[model samples]
Target: MAKSTHDHGAAFRAGYVALIGRPNAGKSTLLNRLVGEKIAAVSNKPQTTRFKILGIVNRPEGQIVLVDTPGVHKPGYELNRRMMAAVHDALLGVDLVCLIRDASVSTGHGDRFTLDLVKQSDKPALLLLNKTDNLADKSKLLPLIEWYQQEHSWRAIVPISALKGDQIQELLDEIIEHIPVGEQLFSEDEFTDQPMRVLAAEIVREKILEVTGEEIPYVTAVVTEKWEEVREDFTRIYCAIFVERGSQKKIIIGHGAQRLKQIGIRARRDIEKMLGHRCHLELFVKVEEDWRDKERLLDQLGVGKEG
Candidate 1:
């Protein structure tokens, strides 16, 4: 990752900055943009981010570890209950908190739920009105900002387009000021802390989310079963996509395994680019009989993992 040249002799400041919002509220996009890497899983589908994704942003003044959490929403399944737990955990012991809201969407119960969390934090928090580009009337922003202003006293509020990279520099400028002075937490060159196996599974899961529709993506979980790096330039990974029932397995594998093959082909391209190694990606479908409800599998999925 390329970083802006900063005066190395100057004081270094770094700390954790949590990005919280409702589902599909652009938290992943903002993390990717701020960190200058595609490490987080992103999809139009809700809850694309299931756990805390750590992204390191290196600036001359300081390094910011962006903590991306699963969107805040009412829990239905055991997995969702764990996701909400992650959101609460991320808010604790963080140097800063950023509540990212989709400016295009109207304020509702979900937004209020997130805002309530922000108010509870009572720490240095920034309200990011994200996806401002999607707003049909730019003038509507003033009222939206006013509403949040009335809701809580924020350190700063900035409207940005995470997808378009609009006003991001301004956002960064604001973020750095709030981060306390300290030494860099991570090496400047490092972009993410996720291991290759977890990332590989996430890449496959992202592809699954993109390829499938309805409840299939939500019902699915990808686990890396094997990773072989026998050669300097070649690697092989085997992953199992777990579903609740055999019928869901069929949906993922498709007829004659064509859909699964497509998933592998597409995922390998991204895996190779991210790892800079030729990867032989293999995927398998398995029915885990409601694996989301199984506590053991949840542990393997990085649930209850810290930021």
Candidate 2:
């Protein structure tokens, strides 16, 4: 990462922007695009982001610190409650809010619920109709945009495709324009606030989401128990995959432990890329018996921790 050479004069602007929306609404994807890095994990699964990840974007005019939060959903467990808390915390400490919605899907109660959250925030917000590239009938966007406008007096309504880099620069420009004038909060070289251990655990968890089915991903959590740099170019990592039931553990391990093996291989590749060094990843599956409801474990994992 390089330091910012951008001007920091009277015209400069900077602020935190929260990415809020329902599950699987492309919030993580949009964050990655805006920050120009994969600091946040990406998966098709809903609630893929369990914690709020901050990614810093340095530009000529301003710096945008993006808070990528977990998908908004009803709380059913301690974990869910904490995730929602993270969302609320982000809403309280931000200069702007971005309500990202999947335009391809028909509007429903869930969408309205998300909008209600934005309304309660009472902050300047931009309604981003994401996944516009996936819309088969582009004409339908007009009605969708109209509906959002009618719901709230948005600062701006921009239809975008977070996956395809569509209108990303325009969105950035809009963000910088709306934020208040201020000095940059972080240095240019800083991209994300996530620690390397947390990132490694997230990458391993993302691999679990990618390799397994829906049930496994939601019921599973990965924690990096050990990280050691044995050499300048080689690192060793050990992660524990916690599951709620023994049967689920069997599923993740798979026949002859091949599934777990595959997950290790996939996660190591990304971890190595992130570390810029060779990595030896070790994984172990453990049955935690409904760890999502355990407060101590959640504390250790830093889930729902205050920003």
Candidate 3:
């Protein structure tokens, strides 16, 4: 694989690009694709992302700081409210805003809601019609792109399939072209702004989302209790998954602790792959009744807290 080379003597271009869109619009997927790594938690469930995730894309042309934000939607609980607030906070000081939308679906209120934010922002905006592969015909993309172009004079309008890696390179080239010359904001080896502890928590949370059905995923929060780098290139990661009630805890633990074991094995594999080493992941399910509604709990969990 050809990696982006950096020229320390030459001027580097770096800026923040916020990815905003409705739930399940493939915003997280796009971020992972652009960074050439899985920096954000991806799930088929709506509102899978709940915070302003920073993914660093280092390319030969420039370094792009991609902000994968929570989906903009009506708030149903305290967590939802925090998610929306995070989205708004991410918009501030952004050099560019990439409004992603599902190209296969007809434009609806959710799409308009996202576009409204773009109109209000002074930063350069780009309307990305994502998931183009799902479209029955390629010609249909032209009209949708044109419609959005007429509605708003965006910096650029591009169609891409994040899942299929279609037109993604073109999208990155366009983004780099817009960023002004500057110094590299991050090291070439760095792929994300999030810390290792946070990443570990997210990996476990993603497993919870995968194995557990219904609202269990949303009600649960994962926190890293201890992370110790052991000898022999191995690490010990202890994490706790918080739930709102005993029943939820049972659901997470499952019969004979089979579900918990599943979450652990899957998370451990991903963590090892991410760290490029072996890992011993230990997960515990605890009932922190109504932790979602508790402000202090939310603060401790690193949600709704300013960075």
TM-score of each: 0.94, 0.96, 0.93
Q: Rank the candidates by TM-score, best first.
A: 2, 1, 3
Where does candidate 2 stray beyond 4 Å? 1-10
Residue pairs in clash, model 3: none
Give the C-alpha miss distance for residue 235 in model 2, angstroms. Answer: 0.6
Tell me the tens digit of each residue's lDDT in model 3 across 208-291. Answer: 899989879788999999999997699999999999999988889999999999999999999999899999999988888788
Which parts of model 3 have CA positions greater than 4 angstroms off? 1-11
On residues 1-307, what C-alpha lDDT tens digit does candidate 1 reach at each position? 1123333465768989999999999999999999888888899999888888899999888899999999999988888888888889889868999999999989999999899997797779999999989988888888898899898888888889999998898788778878888998888778898888888899999999989988897789988999999699999999988899998888899999888988999899999998898989989888878777777777775655552
Q: Which stretches of candidate 1 lie over 4 Å from their true place?
A: 1-10
Best-performing candidate as measured by lDDT: 2
Q: Against the unseen true structure, what C-alpha lDDT does each candidate score?
A: 0.87, 0.90, 0.86
Q: By lDDT, is 2 or 3 better? A: 2
Ranking by lDDT: 2, 1, 3
| Deviation in Å, model 1, residue 217 alpha carbon | 1.4
